[model samples]
Target: MAILPKLGRAIYVLLGGILFTHLGSYMLLPFFAIILSTEKGLSLGSTGLVLGAGSIAFLTGSLLGGFLSDRFGRRLTMVSGLLIRGAGLLGFIWGATFPALFLTNLVAGVGGGIYAPGAKAGIAALASQGTKTTAFSYRGVAANIGVTMGPLIGTYLHTRSSTLLFGGAAVVYFVLAVSHLLLLERDCIGEDCPKVDRQGIRQIFTDRPFLYFSFVTIFVWALFTQFALSLPLRAAQIESARNIGLIFTASAVLVILLQGTVTRFFTKYLHPLGTMAAGIVLIGTGLGSVALSTSFWHLVASAVVITLGQMFVMPTSDAIVADLAKPEQIGSYFGVAAFVFGAGEAIGNIAGGQLMERAVAIDYLPLPWLLYGALGLLLGGAYYLLRLWQPLAKPLAPVMEERTENNPSPFRPKQKT
Candidate 1:
């Protein structure tokens, strides 16, 4: 009971910061496709090339960021990343040229890449035993909050000036940077923290279980990327841009409302492996259902199913990463996972786009979707097998005498006897 307030405060601060960061990021995401095509007069191929550069840079940056987080500290790495991201956003206001835009994306991608591992690792480090899953679920909820609000706000600003929207995102990043530097304590450092020899990407690969998990999740991430890459275009085919936006907003709202309850329910009743597999199956089925959609209502139902699957998998996956990682190497594990995630999304966007083109060319879009759905279900079955081979790892034994009734401040450094 006594620990509740402190735990809640920590969670609130982290969640609040994440919400603002995601809000700023999403505000610009919707503008990218429209701006590149209409304002810059770029062909679809050229637009893809420009966008793909950022994804590549971001994956590279994730590896570097993970190393830095493990070597230095999470708070410092996060603050530095946010500041770099702010500069990238500011660049968009002055540099409207093609080369400038590409450079802006590269810099911003690196910044985002650096921040992710540190932020996720810090959250895991701070979360109490038995609560890491819940903590990550809250993080997902925070993201949904930002996703819901930021684009709506951007839509209004976008009508006035793209410059204004860009500036707004920059300001938000700057504020988040300052807040992180001032408010986030270095819980990932200090004497109480684990002292392990620094390991690199090589060590990450040696952990076969984690490697396998990352491999499977790449396909999962690819499936999720369809929402950004192909789902909108499909929606646009049937409805106006405004209606498509609303459909997305509704999906975010669904996740925001239901993520916590769903996460709790699944975690309580199901094995993490089973829960994740079920979620993946739902995502694939939801996406495949898109082939059958002839109206807005059908797409809406598909989105709900997809969102529910996401609600199940996201938090559980993060928790699984935390569980697999050694406390000191959490950032590294997350970094590797992020790299795989970025790679999957990048591949998904590029491949999914081409597949869509081919499918549309043949006038049989359902073929590609059916194949994707089968892949997802097959992957889920594979994960079940992997779970049997390598059961989830347990928490590390604490270095200090744990606090309870006798010692209330468990987080404080212990004294010499």
Candidate 2:
């Protein structure tokens, strides 16, 4: 195979891995609460608590997994997570009770958390210089494709039996795990990988630019999570699960179609900071329009707009992390990114629930939508300001030869931050 074809093949494996992972996860996610409430005989409040536990576990796992990925290897960490997650899914299918469900969900969440940093770091490690944004864009494409397919398939299976749906999802994860084991290269984990001690780890938390970036991204993620939390409530006019599915599918389709072109356009026409800021602005505008969506088609239009914004934001944010991190610390940086997102989702869920509840009680369905839209705009301004105020970390030099075979230090002196 020619070099480009080889590169494409490698990228495809990575993208396929991500696609299957997301599809499997999404397959179960959208209807999980409903399953708990109806079939599992849990109260809605109890369902929230169970899911919250999973979120907490995910956060904990993300932090720890990052450290391990840097220490042992990304491939090891990622594969272990996938295997654990697959087992968890099977356990969930067999357990048939609240405690079992909760524990299994928590296990799966932890596995997902562990898998995330390593997966993202792998992308950074594999991508060539100057193509990091475009490379990450493909990840977005894969994710959108998975998100589009997973729920539809899950819903179809769900009609037959929840067990079958969950089983199918488990099988998907198992296949993904096998693919990663066979296809993913081990070269990214170099020999002589430097270990970050407690103090060094503390330094990562204290790093101003990274800290700022992570904090800003929290709001961005919170905004994104609103699609799951608040939009459904607003679109209550369309109670058909199929219509809801269509709304989500439309968003993913837009992302699948446009992420690469959007990323490339932003790369060429806009500064990195400007690109991110513009995306945030679009997110806000798209969300603000949700106030006007009183029907299914209106909701679909809003979803498309929101997804367009997402196409711009997701890859750019990821590429920014790639540029900021040192090669070995890529996993840790992505870990922090994942942590921020998880935290955002947790917080957003609670706050959005409150907002929706209060609005419903007051007969003000649009209130939460308005608030979320305003928050997105504020986040956009924050991103712009952060770009101006914080000095971006310089990109690392190309990878050095592996030191594991014999050499002591794989890298030269650290580049000044």
Candidate 3:
């Protein structure tokens, strides 16, 4: 509600695009491994390899997408990414073999990688510093709304036909792509856009604090990936597929309902780094609790705990990245975050699969989750200590001065007095 007044047509459009993209993606992606293992008869390790390959491709795309968005413009980069993603989704319809699935995953991962940073940068470009965090929170809410709905529909469609499920998702991406082409305005123009040269690229990588933050957050992302990588598999062992969808739906619903309130509370009381640390602990606790879960309700409760942690971490992390970035380098900064995301996911997929396989083989189902939980707690503490040692850099007022008549771009560099 507080973020409403800050919403313009462009932001609204971006939010819509995000909502649909996630909806389409979650509809099929959450079940991808299940389909592979059950129907295609791929081993869990093989499935993990396929997924990890995609994540590697995604990281590669993040770098390319970030630079491309900076050089070309957000609108063009987003449109192209969406189209490519749609094509990748369509590929799933015919991907019955492991190699086919791997190739499709690569294509989809690259497309998603390209789209994400551009969209985040577009949000940064449109939002003022005062409203930036709120805007990103709303963006998270929109994506969660999609997450909430996607699994429910996907469950139904999957029961009917895999083709319908994958095809439907492809349609959503294609439609959003068209909408972006028609409605989204270009954010970068003329000299207002920062030229992303070799030096700028190097500067981004060499940013010590930002790199540290990203590195620490990588563990969090690894834990986050378990929702798709390990949780569903765990749930399937104890519950029906429909119930697994319900668990995911419950998590998303909690985020939709509580994200705004949680974000505000944390922002008002805790430093951003503190917020991140606390959120990570909650996530660890939730995932750790999964070892004790025995039924559908128990899984849902654990997911709810995880969602609460996400409410704190997701928006705060995005805002922190935005704050760290120079206005002109927002896309590249988010790109770096995306790269970290991809790396974390890759590690999670490969490692989680092996952990699950070994645990099941040894009849020790709780082993992987307990280990995951411990890692999360340790990383969370490390992050909190890092915060104490070196606080995050606040936005520089002179560097990000507001737009004026002479300075048309909202993010233009301030002139010396």
Candidate 4:
């Protein structure tokens, strides 16, 4: 315990560093379909299919990682995941076709997923008095930055060579694995980790708030998944790849700047339920606006609006799970939520590929239609979650109290940014 706080800030930075690598590796994915379709005798849909399979595998691994990390401890879960992920990256280099891609991506997803719960819970475990929100916020900032940089890295690599990109990613994962072994290696879960008795899928199913937030995550991802799949298509149709990229950059910047303060303010002032509602409403409004977007600027405006919502809701949703969880089952709770979103995102991309793009220079309007449908669901689900939240006891000091109780060692790794 004495040595725990000694290297606290350093560990936090390291955790953030690895997360950036994780997101960086896949930055080329949005371009994968376009890159490989011509060379591999694969269609755009085939690229989407392989990527989608990886998402599904990731979702599964997230659930598994969350549950197991609670029991196995963060050090073991994270290290094991890093090693296996390295292996998967090797497979990616050796196996380049659609089937090989799908298989390799699956391994990467699982390895990545297993790391999520441990990373998140581990960070929270380190929070001291009046600073847990700040701690998590810092973690989130690191994650967002990593996620932001990943696309740029991926883009650069794609411009060079696909094989080089995969090979480089594999090396990064290997380096990350070694770094984890060398630094901040904790053998057990933090003293403050949630303790559960026979935690199971059934327990997660019974947690209504968890379920509701999970639903919200799904809709939000499904709605935004367009930028990765359809936005470029739409842009290409309008001959505005630069415009589309700019739109995405603007959104990412907004999120990176405001997310921390937004999350902290809402958590400090509002109920988690209300924060969740605000998120859905803002995202819905943004998505709704996208349907009406005829100009690139309109789409950019929607991105700004929706990202603000994401800033508030996504972190609050995680905190709410932390608030409502039975200490022992925290990992399982978060894992399930991640899995739900992972699965939804997987479906969203694969479906978007088919629904949004045309192969023979044909265009489909499914992008806007799907966005509209997702927006509606977000609105409806927010209402339902709100109603359920009404009868629940609202606490004021879980954040503060948690900080007081867990001070001196909140160096745990958090989930994706």
Off by over 4 Å in 1: 1-6, 36-46, 188-201, 236-242, 391-417
Q: Candidate 3 on 41-65: residue-level lDDT in tens?
A: 8899989888887777778888888
Give lDDT for model 1.
0.78
Please, what are the lDDT tens digits per residue for candidate 1 over residues 1-417? 342224466567778878988898888888977887777676788677778777787787787787778777888888888888889878877776678778888998898888888888877878886677778888998998998888888888789888898898989988888888888777555655455464544677888778878888998998888877677777776674457777778888887888778866765555567778899988888888888888888878888888888998898888778878877688888888888888888788878989889988998867767877887788789777775773332221121112122233434466679
RMSD of each: 6.8, 7.4, 6.6, 7.5
lDDT of each: 0.78, 0.77, 0.81, 0.65
Q: Candidate 4's residue-wise lDDT over 57-166, tens digit each?
A: 77888888987777777667877877777678678656757888788889987888887776766655555435545555555556667667777888888788877777
Regions of model 3 farther than 4 Å from truth = 1-5, 30-52, 92-104, 155-165, 189-193, 232-242, 291-296, 356-369, 391-417
Question: lDDT score, residue 388, model 2?
Answer: 62
| Residue 262 displacement (Å), model 2 | 1.0
Q: What TM-score would each prediction reach against the true structure?
A: 0.87, 0.87, 0.83, 0.78
Task: Return the TM-score for candidate 4, rounded to 2 decimals.
Answer: 0.78
Task: In angstroms, give how far residue 31 of model 2 lies from its true place.
Answer: 3.6
Worst 10 residues of 2 by lDDT: 396-405
